[model samples]
Target: MLLFLLSCFSFIIVFKSSNLYEMVSFLTPKFWIQLFLRPVLKNHASFELSKLDDFEMSLLDLHDLALDQILEQLSPAELCSLAGVCTYLRSKCRSNDMWEKHMEKKWGRIIGNAALREWHWYMANNNKRKYSISGGNNGGSFYSICSWWPLNLVFRPKLQRKSEIKGDLPPDSIMAWYLSLETGEFWFPAQVYNRENGHDGFMLSCYDAKISYNLKTDTFQARYSPHGRRTIEENISWSRLRTPPIDTPPYNLHISDCLDDLRPGDHFEIQWRRNKAYPYGWWYGVIGHLESCSVNEDHCICHDSETVIMEFNQYAPESRWRRKKVSRKDHREEGNEADGFYGGIRKLYSKQEISMWKSLWPTKVLN
Candidate 1:
């Protein structure tokens, strides 16, 4: 009995020396509760609640909100701010479904589908349809239009005063999305598509629209020419590598830049620009959707200039092109020299114009 008592005393001393009781405390619920809740609870009170004004309170009311709820409840400006907070929020903010929902809200289902289809066709041809759309222009995703654009835009609801024309160009067409290509900034270029009834004089007037992404300039500029670059031999001549004719007329023209209003969901506008000061008071117009800059190279796609090719036909080369031309006398013995002449005529006219006949045409077209 005394030996057992001595053993018990030795065990107690070893346990006390090792502090095993302290270690076991970690297994208790109180210790776990302290460890688990302390960081969140202690930091919670220190959070600056007073800084959250009424604006943020209403937004936070959407805490734990679903995608649809956030899009439907918040304004675009608000959603932009929220998405900018973190990666998790950014991912949730740029959902295509949200854009489509807004699309449907702004335009009817039929119009929305038509617009989306048009956008799809544009992007598909330009190799961009596979990427996200809304985020591409909203300064969120890759090659965005709004990010890094150099501009100080003031959003005015009503016209405080008439827009002072900035350049000698005509009054501004509606400003579509613009870009700062020199700096990879996006701006609102003028858009001018209108409805007018005519058949002979102006029935078929075509407005040419193009968007160029210039890496050096880091800006994207959109242009609209109701009649396209004028055919003054000067313009065409200068377009080529060769020097233009001395008689080439100067292309003295003007454009407009005026956009002062901003609506909640207004993507861009389509308006008109009349160059009354021109030689004939011409009207230049265009319609544009969006512009995306290349992340690596200087490139962009204008919606109107793109086309989707559903099918491409291929053909194999033929050796018939290698046949030697026969002399008139040498062909007479073969009987149909006249036939050879006509055949040569047809082939020369048709095949000579083919892409392979580069040698026959002047390397310098304008010069």
Candidate 2:
């Protein structure tokens, strides 16, 4: 018992050492809880919680109300440490409300329905694999279990992972998912601005990719789709990425809601693609008046007309890439194979969005 007590004392020192703890996550709260229990812990861990005697400087020594307040202020690492002390603390730490806050603070910007669906697939597949390895009960087929999950998500009000609940932790819990992301085990689908590692061709635009965190470098890796070729980019920072602001898929045109507000010199992004086989990418453009419209500011009736001209100044004057016209009242897919196709148009509202595009202006005009 003396040796156990001494070991606990030494562990408290290591736990308090922030640098050491981060360097080795395995030395975290879970590790501390299991350190004393050894081979017998799993069976008796919950029972032993009642037997623990709080000592000096231990948060465990505080009243439940006071401890609860302190827990609210603690960061993720601190919560993890406190959780391993006892079953009651573990319950509080693993609560969905707490994990959800952390998730939003860090990942809410870039994670949307698609990312959530992908996470579900990851959890279901992982559970299925574990079941196969362990000879699961009932022995259901993988396809039968997860085939309709994405569709079912639409009608369901809340996400439930009852099937994935097993062992000490539920794989489907928000806490588990957050930890998976923190550890870089999960690569979620999201969009990155100026992708292709800031290639000039993709500047002022965003593209879809499967992105994952890199703990060592505090960066990210993005895996692009393989229509004809596949590529992966590394060391991408957070500022370059964002959740798709709109739900429209890359191939489908984003239904324009702000077209009625288009005016001369107003900035906008129109979906454009080289061919039907390619996905639509948001290209920066400006709304202009028709040749027949009066140049006088007061006499301009361009916005009221059926046709709205979109100009890309980055292209040479004689280049086919310079200008295109779409119906203001009803504009669908417009363009041919020679000049590429143009889809829906979205008026740029935020000054920041406009500034970001201006900053990426090509040094030379496109032919």
Candidate 3:
């Protein structure tokens, strides 16, 4: 490492090129570790170091667009380190278009359309508060800024420019939104696997919750409604969250169109609740072979049947929780309050979804 640093300085002496040396000097040790040592050592590829023929060849010599393309190769942490090099690089590293891909890659699985709506609402609300409308007295039309409702007959004058929102988190940049999410400033609605803090009763189940990041522990905290005798949950790790397959609300039943297409061994999640007063939770299960049907798919006609057999393999063989039969044509929140009503059903078409649930399989069977 010492020799490497000295050789970098030799660039300035040999070619009188300060740009290369300055850029190298500005990079943090963290960036060096992650960008160089970790990747090279892990990959174990034999890469030959190329010699620089021209003294004028430096990162500063590249076109701004070309430089941006190069910087885009860095991870978010590396980008942060690159940002600290200077003001020009800082602006480049903080590009909204750049951070968008990173944000989506990291958060797309766990945050669905509802969470997106929440994010837009959060940003719009913040933007409304941060910027003052110059036409405050124009027929009280300024009220639309706060409400964000449609402006009817009132003409929206061109917004007067104001100073950018003061703080590390500016609403205009996607990076700020990413930071807000990381810092838990914005709470989003998503489903949590085995919710209610992994209570045994919730094993293999997912429930609706308003989630916020816990940066200190690198976990998450979920706020569930005060229904079904379970409420707040904390210390939710990343693996326990997923974007809802459909943007269905907890109270409303999900309309199922895949009923006629159901087959044995197919995976699915169906809504269930003990009573009408309680919100529904999604329980993972699989379609089971009907008792009279043969195992062969060639002879199988289960899909044509009006009734579908649902099996919960997590439960013991004799457990009443093991099996449920719901009618396809008449399937609309079937079951008495004593047995707990089953609501809408969503088919698991994504292999990732099935694999995620399988990853969470319990070590022991439930009673």
Candidate 4:
């Protein structure tokens, strides 16, 4: 009986231990948490996979219209880079329709009819040379309308005004102006200098001048409104420059007899050999339309009869003017500088020569 009871107690203890293990397994925190989160985690993973698949499909199988819409937003440089990626892209990029659209958008207003004709010629012969839609050329056969040098304007102060002043007056200033081919506007870089009384002097502070270039005449016309401050005076200061009356004749007409090869639209600049104040420096006057040119046996006379003159007091700060060595080639070729005023003529065909003369001036483009 004692052996039977001992065996029965051992069996009971074994049964209780097995029951406790089953209860613990059902109540475990880790087991229940994992069971709840598995379905949610699997659904999230599937959604992410679907999103990735859609992205890949959109890029690889986009419609032509969609692709074109995307490409339209890219710049010329960006389009060129994209064209190199594949054969399909290359064909799209080389489409004449696309090029014409780009040209019209970028330079339609800036280029005149003559320039547009030139552009059409370039496109027709595109196979012979590399052309860019943004008016840049990769080869020698093409010239872009946007690449031409802009017309420049110079203003010199009149010395007589300062001489007539009684009290302490502000120093005189010089201005170099340029016309924007795109906007048909006149602008110049603002210059800052210290006044004699330690005040700030802002020269050419106003920019209300409108400019237009006539392709047929090769002449520039500018009109200044009565708006904007022209000077840094305490009171309103108006611009001293006055546009010549419209009735003025062309400068080339006067000298056409002397120069048999005179062409319409040629650029003319007035230059004096000697500066009135400083005899050593080159005195350059405003560039104007060449109304007439007359050459006699003794002297050559070219007049800018239609030129507008800006009269102001002459101010030559020590830092304003610098002496540069006169080229022996220029001096010998041009002959002795005329005493009063000389016309420096440049033809459109001689672009290199024109650039060489323009390089002498410090100011080119203000904007």
lDDT of 1 by residue, 17-114 (tens): 86444633432234443455556666786755333322222222334543345344554434343333333444454555444444344223113222
Candidate 4: where are CA atoms >4 Å away? 1-53, 58-60, 85-87, 96-127, 130-367
The most accurate candidate by TM-score is: 3
Where's the lowest-lDDT run of ten residues in candidate 3? 146-155
lDDT of 1 at 124: 46
Instruction: Work out the TM-score per prediction.
Output: 0.24, 0.70, 0.71, 0.26
Top candidate (lDDT): 3
Q: Candidate 1 vs candidate 2: which has greater TM-score?
A: 2
What lDDT is reached at residue 231 by model 2?
A: 69
List residue ranges in candidate 1 displaced over 4 A: 1-71, 105-115, 125-367
Off by over 4 Å in 2: 1-58, 128-167, 228-230, 316-318, 363-366
Q: Which 10 consecutive positions of candidate 1 have the poorest summed lDDT? A: 167-176
Q: Is candidate 2 or candidate 4 better by TM-score?
A: 2
**Candidate 3's TM-score:** 0.71
Ranking by TM-score: 3, 2, 4, 1
So what's the TM-score on candidate 4? Answer: 0.26
For model 2, residues 1-367, the per-residue Cα lDDT tens digits are 9985786566567556634345233323333334444556447645654333321233345576655655666676655544443445566777786678888998887789989989999988788432111121222221122222232222232434423311244676787777677657788988877777767567667777889887667788998766524468898888888776677888888888887889989999889877788887788889888899886799998888878888988878897778888887788898888878889888888898888788778788777
Tens digits of lDDT, candidate 4, 1-367: 9985785576457546654335223323333334454556567755543333233232215577756765665554444433333345545654554455565564443344433343355345443442222232131212121121110000112212311211110111000001122222222111111111112221221111233433334433443333323323221111212121121122221121212232223333222222222111112222222224343423333232223221111223232221111221222112243332232322224465345334333332211
